[model samples]
Target: MNTTINMTGNWKPKLMIIGTLLGAGVGLVTASLLARAAEEGGDLELNGGDLLKTALGVVTTMRSVAALGAGIG
Candidate 1:
């Protein structure tokens, strides 16, 4: 009798790099939009508060997604 098995190696580095780039791109776009919104709001200002809130929201969402993917959620 004979048996054979095949397995694929992980592509974690490439996946990590892609994830990092995607996160960075999201952060950059979010910051730009928040700044633009703050500027257009005139006297109704956030003084970085809006930006901080947006950043926290993004982080929280990412963390939740990661946890769900890892079966922790």
Candidate 2:
């Protein structure tokens, strides 16, 4: 009888877990900042323009992050 273990195949789940944790951490920090801003400004209202701008910024940031390793060797 013979058995083999593929160590290289383990990276996918590890990468996924790291990505999930990082994303969650970022989300928590962003939420904390927003909450602090709202509390200090005493304004809980956000208009459409504000939302659109924030969405665009987030998309741009994600694009930049996605391109991180594209030029690496």
Candidate 3:
């Protein structure tokens, strides 16, 4: 009386896993790029207030993106 969709003999599950891995790979690459940009100091230097603003903006953007992905935005 098992009531589960048996995915053992399906290619769909494999494809889904591959898709997830690809998305994760892309995100990692993007993070690396952002780190490189920060390290190289590509013209984003700011003072106290400006630095706080920039930090807030980046954090807000990340949160918004996560929210949208979670369908909560």
Best-matching candidate per lDDT: 2
lDDT of 3 by residue, 42-67 (tens): 76444799769867986898799679
**Order of models, best TM-score first:** 2, 1, 3
lDDT (C-alpha) at residue 15 in model 1:
69
The residue-level lDDT of candidate 1 at 38 comes to 72
* Most accurate candidate by TM-score: 2
Candidate 1 backbone collisions, by pair = none
- Summarize candidate 1's per-residue lDDT along 1-73 as a digit string, tens digits: 4433333566677768989999799879977887887789864455688779877987899899889666687
Report the Cα lDDT for candidate 1: 0.76
**For residues 1-73, what per-residue lDDT tens digits would candidate 2 score against the true structure?**
4444355868779878998999899999989999999999998788999999989998988788677635322
lDDT of each prediction vs. the true structure?
0.76, 0.81, 0.74
- Residue 42 miss distance in model 1 (angstroms): 3.8
Candidate 2's C-alpha runs over 4 A off are: 1-7
Which 10 residues in a row give candidate 3 its minimum summed lDDT?
1-10
Candidate 1 matches the true fold with a TM-score of 0.55
